[model samples]
Target chain A: MATLKDVAKLAGLTTSTVSRVINNRGYISENTRKKVDDAMKDLNYHPNEAARSLRMKSTNTIGLIVPHVSHPYFAEMISNLEARAYEKGYKILLCNSQCIHEREEEYIRMCINHKVAGIILCSGSVALDVFDGVDVPVITIERFLDNRTASIECDNKQGGALAAEKLIECGCKHLLHVGNIGTLSMPADMRTEGFREVCERKKIPFVEIYTEDTQYYRMEYDEMLENVLQKYPETDGMFVNSDVIAAQTLQTCRKFHISVPDQLKIIGFDDTNIAQLTTPQLTTIHQPVKEMAEIAINLLNDSVAGKLVAKRTVLPVNLIERETT
Target chain B: MATLKDVAKLAGLTTSTVSRVINNRGYISENTRKKVDDAMKDLNYHPNEAARSLRMKSTNTIGLIVPHVSHPYFAEMISNLEARAYEKGYKILLCNSQCIHEREEEYIRMCINHKVAGIILCSGSVALDVFDGVDVPVITIERFLDNRTASIECDNKQGGALAAEKLIECGCKHLLHVGNIGTLSMPADMRTEGFREVCERKKIPFVEIYTEDTQYYRMEYDEMLENVLQKYPETDGMFVNSDVIAAQTLQTCRKFHISVPDQLKIIGFDDTNIAQLTTPQLTTIHQPVKEMAEIAINLLNDSVAGKLVAKRTVLPVNLIERETT
Candidate 1:
């Protein structure tokens, strides 16, 4: 590893002058800057970001905590977020909590200790009081922790309504909404609310089934979905809360010899890659993942700069009609 | 935001004693350590990792660069790697290079500047000279660069041979092997070699098709796959290199009305989530991703400790029988 002294000696300059050139702390002539740059390049010198961050009391890094990276939705979100953050001269400290409370807490504390510029929380099981005494700017996606933390989420209510309306338009008589357990009271609960309201207003019979917390964590809904199908043989259409579940529903329908789009029209949420990979393809609600990621990064940056940001930001969702409907 | 001095004041101890307790440096009485810990909790104190890292000249972080995080194969790898690294008390600095040389270069420089303990490279398109002068231990997965850099990969050739043997046993008369462009010479190229050797030894007719670099990065192989099917309509069995491409192949087969496992048996590689999400569930080769990740981290740690580690580590792969075959 080459040090500042080596570069300075090679460039025939003082160590302080070289430091100023590297840090851009003071103005230097173009000729002197080029000389220092060439010298550093020749020596393969990289300035220590740890020392620089300590002096600046901050780092060009953001801590992003998600429940699981292997999930299609979070995987897509992380990809978009990493690209957007890199575009703005930032890096991501990736943390996969796997929905463990203690792990999430440890990651949060680690971010604070490292003096990260901000944190983006996309984990589902984080408690509301987790950010009570945190000093760094915290922004969450698809999760509303509390009134103090800024949040960005797609319009879950509108998404649910869109799915219901699409199913009804397809002549679905009895509707089913598969969702997360209602006890969490998450922003996603709005999805069920929207689905039920649309069904009731149109005088259509509907039922909502909540999945256990374990199902969400394991990303498996096959057994539960099979039971749902067996219990509701009269169900003409179904709206699944996530594409992962919707994909499984497609498989389950096959097992029961129920044809999709013919016997039971299906619509999924979060138009991730899994939607298109299914056999008949899936009609889904697009969550505006790329746009939401961009907005989340911008909001974190603004909050870190001491600017007052909106408490809650909701973007619109649209229905994508595919072969399933 | 509470400083060491604040914790010391609250604990009724000198700053030196509090610092010793926080760093776990020189021995301190259990009673004094308890008082310091309680005060830190009360004051909500978080030690500055940046300052500590500066003093130690290394950070408890590993840089992980992958071509695309959204791809199911990489997504699962990342999830496993993060969990393993967390157990070892290290964080991951994630970089989605998207196969751009400049972005990969920038990430490598950033990791070096931050003084990460090691780097795990899972990217497909990185140049061999990228790590020419990198100071940290560089480990490659599924891609072999130079002898100087350590590499870890599953037994890809054996995976390819297994896929071929299974398709033969399933009563396939003709075969096809789909793979990446051969110019890159990645460790995954052995898949093609193994497939071809099996077909030749069995005296079975087979064809090999290579996807363009653009197709690999975009994760879309519909058009090319459509061409392959049309060109080789007699092909009764196929082995795709990755589960992502295999999923797309399944959809393409549907478009052409080709029945899977009846008229044409199919086997995919990597056994990622996409394999299960697809209808008929792909029968494919399973890479030991978790084991590979654990070994990669261990090798990096040992190399960083100045221990002589193996230049190349290869783990075994197994065939998972699903519905497709």
Candidate 2:
């Protein structure tokens, strides 16, 4: 029964301040926020979005579909995206598609029907057909969906090249490149392309290995690493597609009694938390996760507002040299 | 301009199968799902949630509020929760409060306003006052809000006791327990309490250290570890609150020229991905994140359906020993 005006009057603040607290649009000091919240509570003001939807014809929510948040790269990216969305008066409806095409399609359908302002797909499954004829504003991360869709991604090609260059500079004669098998057709495959280019140009003998995509399950990484090690026993350096894979490689190297840098120099991509957690902290290609996330949200907001945005935004990546190299 | 019946007929499947594909409620074979999807696409049949919501008078969505998903534990938990929710025809609206009380409170208010059928709070901050007089069914993880809100948590006290016992059994005379400074009053603080109890009962000389909650910001962990090592140079064993912290401890120990297991036995809680990624893989208390997430969702659903649910659900924890111990 209580309105925003009453709550603002009670809290001695403007209605915009009270609206900001409800929408989480902008910064409000803790003291001001708490006072407004207390006043709203005291007045039993329940400003439910369901009611607002009927009048406004929209909800302040964005749908975010990721392969899986348990993966460190996506997890950190989702964290950044959620923070930026909240600052811009939007919340994320999270769907972990687990890289399944059917599941990703289902989430896209759900988003289209849920009246969310827009959708952000952090998947690389090349399944843009699901969004066909859907009117919702769609923004993608790390994958190029279609001509109509806006996307933000770190330069995977540049990242891969940086890794290859670093390993070669470290005098790695016999190199190995490990990547997720599922990401072969996605933009991330550029990492492998870049790595291969450097290896070919430098006249370095290198082997390319594609491992299964899953990361967290026990012993899978060990098994993959074992197969790679047995097949390429002469490998003196490796460039992994992601930090998680690089960490597993470091662990496997330890098991095989291979000293890093001295025997097997390693470089990883997407410098997520795992890069630092590893013993000889990974020298990785630092994907601009926060920057990409912010840009994705901004593009999504622009699209939702019926404004034209760039078709593709490529952020920069840098090589962070740490103990691993 | 197409319908479920039309798609089902074209796909040569029952309408229920097509409905399952649309709602994603039950298990459908991948082949059947694809056939149905192809039929729907060919017919331009877009089954969205808005129409379903208007008919059912409820949306199949849950609002999940966590401090941040970049933290390994929360990321894994969100992954599990999303999987379970999708299996039951629900999606997650994610809010990362970033451990700010005002931000978290704002999220709760927004959830109350939104059409999400339920809300799950994965925050440790005890600011339940924000939920006062809210109508939505609420469930919390790892923090007890009130009698009205059902909560699920791994036994932090038992986890702490296990950590202490393991350290002592490993011949650690001088021990240390490190935890987040912000969780001092929450249920997680029970870990510290249990560790202290074991130390007091065994008469082991132990020191307690609390660090700021922010992580992944460069040099904070280093500074915290520097201060801890400077103050307690004789510490032979440690029980860190989380695997992330344990990894930092291990890295700091390496810098300080301390060998793990031999000179400094260490154990961490949350047995998250970081537990295995580290070089000397951490021995940690395993919190059944998936099981807890499933239970939390079930309770929220029960409450949403106007059924009474238990006030508290405490899951079990296990001690997983590895190289660190």
Candidate 3:
């Protein structure tokens, strides 16, 4: 229940100016409008008029914000989510953030303006501050944003440890970890920590490499993988953040005449469709993607229905042994 | 420009009943609402009230309907389309049809209700009849719905023929063409036709196989590919419908101990990210996905501006040789 006064105070602006921005009645510059909008979002302030109208009607739609649907992981998640949401008589408003911060913020504002019943944020780059004043119910996937918002995530730490153990069990001497550029912001970074801990416990040597490019596409991953292999030719075990990257790593290994399993054992996270498509089918961590998607939709529905839901729901992950290992 | 009278006439209902459904002003039954909505859609009936209000203010949004974002081809298309649309100061409201007829129809109605400036339909399952009374501008991708609606597609026939020629040039004896169940609806079906034509002209024997399941997910595709390989053990050259399937074909080949390019020279359409991810990088038809996406968005914008856009805009496709063939 943040008020316009609170928004004005947070933005350091006059109440009248905030009201004008809310009504869109005055000649306001783009900067002022953005500041006001940002303040309102930070305050999670809902204009009384909009809030009352939104309550009076049911939109039967939920907003979904993902980094990019073109990415296999998000695409599969969205597919399962949309099907489940449709079964429950709701449609999804898909917002592709494309890993762009400003676009992600814009989509959040648009979702509120359109009166979506709730929002599901799958984009990890979005900062927690942006959700400070969001009025609608939010369910975050994989990323922990706030103490109030509900989040559903697979056990990244456990999965990473499982990968490390499996690779070690295969007698892989040297290990390598490939991570994303913005790795620290995401809870998935727990995977790297888990791997490191397991390697240290086993007294095995390991090297870590991260791509300079963003996580939205996998093209740059192959180049980075090549550089890593060149720098650390003895790397016999590799743990990639995603199956997409692992697939690229496999392709790069083929070019270098590196034999899989015999010479190197590779494990990937998120056993998506691409995992099986790899030459020596990827031995990877299998997250309950469909189940997680179903739970996310239900959580949104529960929040929309004013039910008290858990703030964090962590699902278990398992290792799937395939030809690569 | 269709009137309420036309919709009422088409639905064999009174104007008042149709008006009630349109405005949601009365307690209308689900059956009656559906009939009224269907009739309005059939007549391409633009509700005058919605049109008038929409013209007064720009919505800055466009509706995009695809079979499913999980499908790599569509996912990439959406990624490019959204980026281009954003550059043009517009946002996309994504609708995933999931090959459900009713869902596709419902999304159309929802888009109309949202007052989107235009729509881009990439779902092949959507019937041409549904667009009869669509009020907003529409640009179809790959599917040619009507004379009035604009469409963007790659040269599927040329791409298919190229696959046939490449496989033949690689000294393959037998050939197979894998297709989707809804082949007739999509212009991409021309790939199959072209492959067949080239095979016949070259005096090469070929077989065609199609999955009964829809094209959204690859589970059925794997099953179908297994059955195809089992039935057609002598299949040496294959021209699959998409790179996703090509990747699957490679995986299945591995399971059956059939080496690609040596035992079976294979080519696929839509050289997506997964194409390169495969070990023997897919030798396939490369459609200008990004350019096509940009054109589709521009066509929608043109239509929204009442500009004379072409009915069909076919982009060229090229064969990119890698390791498979």
Candidate 4:
């Protein structure tokens, strides 16, 4: 087996420099890093990460627990996080908790056992006690577990307000907001609150309906949305908390023979791929998914390095105007 | 730190039994496993995976490299793969290559250096030499790198033929097939072959159009699709290789004022979330993604255990008929 010395000799670098590059330590230029990487590849030399991690007491791995990646939002988030983590010489240990609290707890325990550098929790579980004894840095996305846990989330409240404002500006008289039902308070619930606040201030009569957790998991809201449309026949505008639900709303509108933008203007949160794929393409509140992911990874990295990071990060959202409005 | 002996004493089991459960080396009953797990959790005992992996010469980690998880198809695939791997006591190191060959190679080398038990390559890279000196077992999904490499793929040819037949049965006159362009031959190329054979047999006039790699990466085919639709104005039935492209075709049809299921029928591949989220709910060829993932993991496990495994396993596909048909 080739050693670090062989790789250094091949790359025309010192042993210490090669070691620093291998461990991803302080300041290595990109050109020099590339040279070392190529030399390591050419020599088929692989520094045993197990031994190195044992000595350093941490692996170049980050644990990312998400409810599920099948959702376009989380899917895109994972793509961005994984890419960013890789650029930082870190690998992501992916955990799909499927919104199960026990599963989420198990994954956290597993990450701790593996001595991951940090954990990024996006599972939507409100159980704050899961991180009771975890020593690793924990950064959350969209879910604020406790006061101490670092979180990176988009401006969901502003997103909601933006959607409501867009609908009203499009000549909507009676407005409706569809949101998910949660037992405990979550940062995402602010979306509904912001929408409600905007509607009240604007003096626009609006109704709110919450879908059960089952609907969110199954990614089906056609029946609930159809029922909402039936109950509120005068609803001229709708703002859904998620693009998936909003897309279903569009289908429901088609089923009821209601034309979008003409009869019922609609807006959705989480400008995921579904927003663009829908016919009359959905107008939506665009969450900075990539930016949030990058920030979350950086925060986790900083926290792992014993650098102080802000407890909360809220990036702004944008109103994406499309055919729906 | 709580020692293994303490955990064994707390669980009322021998240290050897606790070690067995921790290492996942030998069979243990569910009741005993639960007891050990509970006792460890109560004691806050975390078995150092780095030390264990060093002793065993392999870590309980599987490197999963996909083109991009942002794509709903790969997203769902990663979800299934991660869930199944976790069930088998393995963590997934997610690497999204974005279809970049150099990045894919780098990730592969990193996985090897990290001593992953196996690698699941879902990236659509055809470079055969990248795996020349890889010591770990590699299982490719959807791409066949070489004859010796193990691969788990869906019956692309059958999927293609099914879509073609479904479109023909829907009373479409002229047929159009949209596929991706690739320099090297791949198992996915069989999809086009199957479609071509069915068209030749049916004596249906069909035209094939290929999208560039850039389009695939960008996940946008609007302009190319629009051009195709304009050039082939007589085409009424379309079969797109992916749901993303098919969704774009739907948008293009809407742009052209072409009514679906009335003036045209479209069938999509992969049956991802996009298929269902589309306004008309795309009819698609459903690849058994979960089953394929499960099989691939099991095959990798078997290979790692020095058990005989098949070189190629092709699962069947089903045509999901929806509003588009």
State how far residue A291 of model 2 sits from its true place (Å).
Answer: 0.7
Q: Which stretches in model 3 have alpha-carbon errors above 4 Å? A: A1-58, A213-218, B1-58, B215-219
Which regions of candidate 4 fall more than 4 Å away from where they truly are? A147-149, B147-149
Q: Whole-model lDDT for model 1 versus the true structure?
A: 0.88
Question: B8-52 in candidate 1: lDDT tens per residue?
Answer: 999999999998876655578889988997897788888888999
User: How many angstroms is residue A321 displaced in model 3 relative to the true structure, after the best TM-score fit?
Assistant: 0.6
Candidate 3 chain B lDDT trough over 10 residues, lowest sum: B49-58
Residues B1-325, candidate 3: write the lDDT tens digits.
6788888888888999987776545388878977886785565454533233334433556888887677789889988998898766576777888666777776776676566678898875566666655568888888767754688889989988898889888899899998656544678778888888888999999998875545444444777789889998999998888888898889889889999878998898898888888878899899999999999888887777778888889999999998898
lDDT tens digits by residue: candidate 3, A86-202? 766566778878667777876776666566678999885676655554567889998767654599999999988999999999998999998656544778888888898999999
* Pairs with steric clashes in candidate 4: none
Report the Cα lDDT for residue B91, model 1. 93
Cα lDDT tens digits, model 2, A80-180, are 99889987778899988887877787778767677788889877565656667777778878776766568787888898888888888888889988875
DockQ of predictions, in order shown: 0.79, 0.63, 0.21, 0.85
True contacts kept of each: 0.94, 0.83, 0.50, 0.94
Docking class of 3: incorrect
DockQ-wise, the better of 1 and 3 is 1
- TM-score for each model: 0.91, 0.90, 0.81, 0.96
Compare candidates 2 and 4 on TM-score and give the better one.
Answer: 4
Cα displacement (Å) at residue B158, model 4: 1.2
TM-score (C-alpha) between model 3 and the true structure: 0.81
